[model samples]
Target: MARRSLPSLRPTWRRRLTLALRGIGVLFVLGLIGLIVAVYIQKAQLPSFDELKSSPNGQMIRVHAADGTVIVSIGPSYGEWLPYDRIPAVMRDAMVAVEDRRFRSHIGVDPIGMMRAVKLAVANHGNEKRFQGASTITQQVARTIFLSNKYDLGRKSREALIALAMERKFSKDQILELYLNKVYFGGGAYGIDAASRKFFGHGADHLTLSEAAVIAGLVKAPSHYSPTADADAAVGRAGVVIQLMVETGKITPAQAASADLKRVALAPEPKQNSVRYFTDWALPQLDTLIDESSRPLEVWTTLDLNMQRAADAAIRANAPAGAQGALVSIDRDGAVRAMVGGTDYVTSNYNRATKAARQPGSSFKLFVYLAALEAGRKPEDTEVDEPITINGWTPHNDSRHNSGTMTLRTAFAYSVNTVAAKLGQQVGFGTVADMARRFGITTPINTYPSMVLGTSDVHLIDMTRAFASVGNKGVAVTPYGITKVTANGDTIYEMQVDRSHVLVAPYVAAQMTDLLQTAVNTGTGKAAQIGRPVAGKTGTTSSNKDGWFLGFSSGLTTGVWMGRDDAKPIPGLHGGTAPARAFAAFMKPATANRPIEPFETQVTLPEFQLEPDQEFGQPDNGGFVDENGNPIDQSAQPPTDQGDEGAQVDGDGNPLPPAGDGRVAKPEKLDQDWMDRVLGRDTPRNQPAPGRSPQRDRPAAAPPPERPADRFQDSRPTQ
Candidate 1:
């Protein structure tokens, strides 16, 4: 029967099909050879393992100014290195469960996983972009190390080959470590180490399952899943990761549900730089300051709401284009009252007040003066103001008129550089540096003669605290912002004032204060005078690269700085100009209702005889005067000199008729009640959760009384 069939075996259709099959097989073999050769060539060009480990990423660390107010967040984290053993097991489980369910059974590349990915891609109408990736953890490691994010066959073939090599060369744990360390987690972070610290103020090893899930979810698209950039999207992505984890039995359904309810809800955060700067500074301390298992925090700060408003307004109104401004204020008790870390939070979140270390110019002269006073030199003592060289670095005075021999008082008033240099030399550079350190200059000091002219860099908060010693009658203060911190409404930590020892002798501080008072009262810092007893020094760097005004009243010490973020010089900018003026503006509004008080001096001031002189040195010659020297109308009640009254006072201080529709300016108390509400003093029983902005009410904010000269003149300086 077989011999009979063999005669018909060579039918036309069968012969043709056989030839076609042979030709197709030959083409397929040739194509496979070409692909292998192409892959080898591409793999040779791919980066080695060392190079891919250094790629950049987004990492965010936030700062806050007030309680429950996020001020700023630092970004672009340079990833912190962490070892495999240091990583939490749960964190590893979360990542593996969501990223590679077959991670344990795979040999570099997973055929089963690839088929699954292909199936999903087909379901999505062949859109590979939406396809679930089949890349094993080992494959990901290879791609991350050796390939760009391109969707091409050559890259894919090489990636698989490299992954197979990696699997042969390293253990499973090693591959996992490599992947975890190199993966990008958004907010300027790379690696699990940086991601954990950037978002939770801790290391990867300590991450909870929920936080780990979020980090694992971020591997797909960092920008879309960035908590600060888009909280809802980030949380939604985390939910998907959790779903995968649960489906794989890596985590219990209850665990996934709990993480979704708690972890995802914690993603959203505020972005303003002013409050963020403080929060960023305080966040890390929470781990040390409170129990690790505490719930979400409600950190209270020593930020006076009124003063915070003043600082914010001053920076925005006075900083020039291309120049950012920062202001920090503290009370004698070392409580930070207010701070402005940046001018426009939206433009740049870099906190000049907290992070920048710029030359303070003449503002740092207080330390030099303090050193001089402590060395037994009086304010009236004389020093030569001639030009001098320090290690061949010549230093010059701001003006020719400032040259020549002058009193220490005069030198300080004009912010004369030569005299400060002379003092630094005489008193010793080490002495000056030590004194500055004692007075709260936390930034490392460059103990050179130029340091006398404020050539050294220091943070604004520390610099403000230095002057606060003058305000506190020589008592050194440790500037602090966090007053209390609660976790999920439970008390966790509280701040205790550490102002104790006198950093400077009372007489020395008094003499220094007298010298600085001359600066604000009549010299370089004259624009900073707030119609009250206040003293400060003006500092303008060489070529006006930086301008600073550090001053203090009896109740508050404040420092202001203005300069370009790039440290470029600003045209026509001076410490005595806008910076000083801004200080005055902030104080005028901030100190409205508080009774004027006198700073502690070596000797009791004459006008401050009774009740410890709450007159701000406004002589007891019986009346108060405005900044323009206009006599203050101090009648407790409304004035009765109404000329058919409808209007009270004109654009000027002169009384206008009642029919006069011209708006009048009158000083009023700051609405502290509204401030209390903001600081979480008395929350309404029916308000939103903590950190959400509540409906506000302001009943006390009032306009400044107009001066008679302001009526017809455009005297206001451009901000």
Candidate 2:
């Protein structure tokens, strides 16, 4: 029975094979449909040259300095693209030889080249990660148009299908032209023509064989082999491309041997020098000016390249070793002219100028003084010299010596610690802090007694903005770096000065400027004085930790800070030292040609008044007196006033007699009325009285009694 069943099993096998074939056929049809849909999706996303040309956002992104000098850029303009006929044959051959030797023979994708790349990748065991990229010119063009600057399997698959479609649609020459025009050569250049001009200062047609090879070599990794970015790597890679050209017979062996892989001298392009400092500060404001988009826009900033270079140089030259510093300069229009984040931008990307929060040292004193000025205090007002304790903290003068008494002008000029502290106390710490915030210092200030000592933290940018306001004549101008932004010739964003009245009166700013000018001319900021009119202040933190010079001319205001990134004390360095030196050096040249316009000082003071007690009183004979008003000779009397004893006086108002041990006796306490009359309560202690003898009450001499008779007798006998 089993043998009989076996004969029918053959038919069952035929049915099973038929069913399997049907299933395979169905799957194949589904895969074809899916492939067609993917092709349609990719084609829909592919951008044509017409689309690129007509796109409203195709304009290049340009960054300009305050003076309208282009510093950096992205994207390409019409002037950057070139026609195929403009390309040199050597460059065209070199690119084809190195990237795809059989470029003309292949339809779009080079299967042989892909297989070779795969072989090399396998031989290297993935250790040489970047050994393979076998995309042909067509595939590369497709990727550039439809994908991002990233490597992935998804991109590779899309690139393959696009290459096939491109071959069916366009000629080999057209594909090659698009590829040359579309590939990125880094350094902000996007095509062979732009790359040639950027790296060699010449057009593609004029590129030498060696230069052409270098450009072609960059197709693999533009940043890695960019002549401006890395010269040695670029030259090394160029040598490989030249060798490939020789092996492919595109270039003669002799030509390859003669070719020197000379590094092409790149033409100067815009460079971003810690621009993040300014951009980060300007970005938030930019949002209000323009809508967000990936479209390229041109942002015209108020930065002056020369001034920015000068400011950067000053910060670098004066910044402490292993330390970071920041500098910001703004013009009278509240436009930021220059900004520097640190010494070397390439070493550290951290922008210290706008982001770092640091105690401004005495630079913060400006705000305190501004507060006092607003509170109806005159620069010439006299303040007492004495120890003042506020909030359990004692603020000492920079000199650490009691001034005894000083005018507000002198106090601020010398940065007298005691005077500023007292003034801050007079105008409430909260008031001073609030005034500072209104002036652009956003950081919270400690309301302690030391706040007047600039114990509060602030960024250099904010500090510069505050100082710039003074130059703006009492208007607190919100500093803006970017002036305007445009996309495809349409105005998208415009920056205008947004200012507020922080000072009580515009004339008050002028008065403060006068005081600051005095500081530059003959005070602590003497080192910062330039030939032109300059007004500024010097600030040195306790223990010489931070040095700062914040000053301004008629047109520009800048603040500089130098200190260790860790806030460690720098020995023997103060604001008036290196920081001021750098500021003056920069300001001298920057303002040399400008006119010397003095800041307006409207408030005037009357001549200083003299107190009665400060005048000399009538001369009295030098004589000791008793409590009963009896005069006593110094020879017959002992000293009256002893160590640590109060001044002793007799009823006659003369010094009292001393005791037997030669120690002066302590005088009894005088009545309040007597002290008031004698000390001249309303007058200073050093004034002189009218018609008083300048020299009186000094010690008198003993009388000469007689000469020796023996001396006279001896002279007569000799004669």
Candidate 3:
């Protein structure tokens, strides 16, 4: 009785429908209020419209060579900022036709485009990969200026709110200006002007219809459809943009047909990207020179395009198979004229010139000799070139046998390891290391006896710079690339020429130059001789893992390195064989523009007379001596080819017989260095040759050549 019959609890269908509709309507109102609040919050977090208007579009750094050739353009590249009226009408129409057809009628966000995007997303089962975007040009401008490319409901809402705010504050023309000036178009280009110049080699103000369409098509996927990356895809995308323009009444059918799709050529790209290595090294220095700015900068560097081209050609021509090579050239004032980091930049951009630190091998002896000379040792002073042991370590000459006692000049010119070791020990290893530091070697150097033979690793650029100091006549120079920097036609920084920094006494530098010249003229670095005058030393590491040739001529200093990236041995790879050859080849052309200049100091080399028993063992005779100067048992040794040791080769690395090899067709000598003396190269000298008796006043044959002594043949520690 208390429960009384419950009245009919079920409502009629019409009533149920009305209740449901009311609930739905309430939820919709709440959602709308929440959306409005979220949008207000997003807009509040964004920059003000005035702040956006004053912000710079982007920052670009254009690096130019000494001759005004563009080496590289770093960062996001922006062109001249044009007003709405200055922009080509064809470009504006193309952008509207392809990006947002209802751009003029919509209030920042287009409802129809959103609905279509939603339908398409649902059809694709919410696949983010295949989802199409619905943002208008206004939304893109807001995102580019105020947001990252994060995809989420919160970001989309903020974008829309920002777009709405922008449209309310600025007119349609202003929005278009912002969009065209701030949008990215791949290839590091930002803004319509930059994009046009990047693809068509012209400014946006001079855009053709087809060119405008090509740029407009890049809005969807800048990188994928970039003309420089994929030309066919770029053309196809441009075709689609043209079709859309025709359908949107921006162009006629006949105009679309005559769009010249095939003629949409891209601006020529740099032939080689190796210049990037130089730019990468030079860009970091800008921070120390000037404060960060939004305006574009023009950096005038010390690079010589012609020298760079010559260096590249030399490396390509001389690098052995299965090996990589790097080169660096600097002027007397320490300006980097050219730098080749590796055989090819695309395959590997490790920047071996500035980054890779490898053992300098015998080339390290430069510091040893310099220390000795500064320590009161004279070139005429004699050192016994016999076997030497230091701290249980033994060093050998490239030929493995001693050349007996010789002048300090002769030992240095020969790159004799024992003499260098003795010199280092006498002058103190720490003193040698100090000398290296004074010469611009920044890497850590071990203060050990082995360091005298170049056991420590160093950068090619640093080594080249050290020689540049010598070339500067004992002046200490900091290797520099950027000489001046300008921003918006205003000078921000200019390199000051300071020549008062001296590293050594002029006499000491002159002596070192004399020794290095002898090395090139009559000793280990004979292959590097350039006919006029060059002073340098060659280095061949233990097991032939690395080869080096560092020299200076005509006020330009250069260093060459050849090796494998893995630090493995290259068979029969001596510094004189390839590295010195490359040096000569590059220097011949690089120094052609520079006038011939003689070294400040010159010295008379002492004559070294060899007894019949001490003669350099002919390649055919059984007169060879072992590492200890003992006669070798030719009977126990394996037989080898009987070709002349002085065989020559053409530019193609093909070998040619010696002049007197008895071959009917003797190939002409490629060069006339000491190596040619083995084939009896004859030249008239006022005085007798070094190895000959002081008797005749006429031309005489050079004495027998030493066994390929221009090498760091091997190194080992006895147990």
Candidate 4:
């Protein structure tokens, strides 16, 4: 039957062909309608030319100094816009050759390039560059500025439509400029200029062929090809770009050879992100001030770049070997001028200045003394300096000597542990803790007797702020870094400059300043004196684990801390030694240009005497004698070193020469001449004679029966 009816197989074939043709026509019309609808939707969603030209696709926060110097840039960053003429010819050519070979010949979406990319992807087993497919430079620009990378058909269609529209609206040169200026080059950089500066430490106009190739190669997979992320991969990708440039006739083989990949060096970061310690502290503050956005922001900070450099250098120079150091500087207006979290920021990012809660040692005595003064205890009030046991805890002076009777001024200046502990008891420990809070110390302060001796751990920034309040004439100083934030050159948020209420009465602050001044002038903080009146305190923790010097001179206040991160004792470390020296080193340059302002009020300093006059025929028994006229045991007692253990002072507050051959014991291997070398100071303090060993045994304190640790063992050097 089938053989007989080969019947009109021709008609059946024709009917099938007609059905197929009709289906194809209907599909063609439907496709045409869908394409038109997509075009209209994408066009409606398209941004204006002005918006596309100026708006960034991501958020960027640029932190600036008071002088507008960029301290650091956070998130995606952009550099100055470069005109087409200013863009290096090699940069433009390299980008064209590697990213879109048919860039100039095509409208925007190059079919030939797409086909080539398809062939490559198939040959490579679908391992095309991440974030890069067959998109042309113009299409990439459209995607970057206009469309999301949703990996959907609609996104790609929109990208093509925008690219075509861009081609018609802008000249080829203008399109290329937009592409170069708006594309991401990774490492938080956007735009050719930003990427050029980020990679080569210069502008796009100064890009060499190698540098240009390196930047151009990053367009495929910015994060993967970023030189900062992987230098070798970036160089390899750059080599591919150079080869493409040669193959595309953008450069000859000889020119490719001249584009030395080995010469492509990435720019070093801003002092190895040393300022990150500052920016990390300041960036989170912005979230509270403004709504999140993709727009670029400029954060004007109170940071002084010069002061920051000086503080960093000082910490580096003065921090002892095997120890970490931190410094924070603030101005009278509570502006944070400089902050150094550690000696090297790259090694350890733990912000010791603001984050580390360390025992302030004798620095905590500021609050104790302030509380005492507020309790109506005059600085000249007298107290006996004998061994005192409070709650079964015997507190000894750092010197381990009972120097008869002394005024409160002399006691606080010398950081006498016995006297401070006694004062803490006389004025309630709770009141002392309350005083600390009033002075801006936010850490939980313990009301124990040892709290007066700084057993409570506190942040350096808080300690510095407390001292700043005193320097600010009792006006509470809330330490701040950001002054204002601006988006696209328009103000978004600005700090309302309001100094907090008075923390203490003006006269009380003046009295406290007088005591601090005496400490720096003739006591433990002597090393911090920078040829001017300095109101400061010296703090050395148990076994010299932590040494701190917080001082204010003129209108600037700075705090310096030095110790092991693990809280191990530093050999022969004292607050008056390295910490004070660093304070002086930093403050000298930090305040060099500022006007010198004398403290508004000065208390009449009483005559401080620790020993009887030689004319009285009092034997030089080292200022210690019992009521029975017998010489006290001096064996194994810690000698008064530079800090806290008061140096012999005349009635006029002048430091007397060392006793017994005048050879002071110095820390081993420390540069005694660092002040002369780094600060150009001619005056050299006590220098140990040649061949004298710096090592001196510090007798560990006999811990109290039930105490956790002997807080009475003076951390400061004793006479």
Give the number of the best model, judged by TM-score: 4
Judged by lDDT against the true structure, how good is candidate 2? 0.66
Over 1-719, each residue of candidate 1 has an lDDT whose tens digit, in order, gives 55554444578899999999999999999988875666566556555545444443322333345555554434545456666787787778778887787888887789987777667666776455644557888888777666766765567666788876676656788778788987778766768887777676777877777788778888878888877677778778778888888888888889877785244334334355465555555567666776644233456677666678778888888887778899988777887777788876667777788889987766777888788889899876787756566665455432222345657775666555567778888899889989888887888887755666666778888888888877788887877777786644466677877667878778887788877776664355646767667788777654456778888875788899888878776765667666877888888877777687765431111110112111111101101222122333434323223111001322222343333334333232213232233223463444433443333232233312222211111222111
- True lDDT of residue 141, candidate 1: 76
Candidate 4 is scored at a TM of 0.80
TM-score versus the correct structure, for each prediction? 0.51, 0.69, 0.74, 0.80
RMSD of 3: 9.2
**For residues 1-719, could you state the per-residue lDDT of candidate 3 as single tens digits?**
58778677666887989999999999999988886776666656667656665565567788999999887878888787878999998899999999999999999999887788778767777566554668999999988998888866578777888888777667999899989988999988889998988888888999999899999999899999999999888899999999999999999999999999779778887565667777778889999999957788999999998888889888888888999999999988888989899999988888999999988877888899889999998887898877777786666543435767888887777676788889999999999999999989999998867778777889999998888888778898778989999998899999986889888888888888988887766556656767667889878765567788899999999999989999887764666668888998899989987898878754334335344334221111111222122334545644322211111222222343433533323221112232324323353444555454455223235542223221211111100
Q: Of 2 and 4, which scores higher on TM-score? A: 4
**What C-alpha lDDT values do all the predictions have?**
0.65, 0.66, 0.76, 0.75
True-structure lDDT of candidate 3: 0.76
Candidate 3 vs 4: which has more lDDT: 3
Model 2 lDDT-worst window of ten: 710-719
For candidate 3, the 10 contiguous residues with the lowest summed lDDT are 710-719
**lDDT by residue for model 4 (444-490), tens:** 88776667777778999999999999988889988999999888878
lDDT of 4 at 595: 81
Rank by TM-score, highest first.
Answer: 4, 3, 2, 1
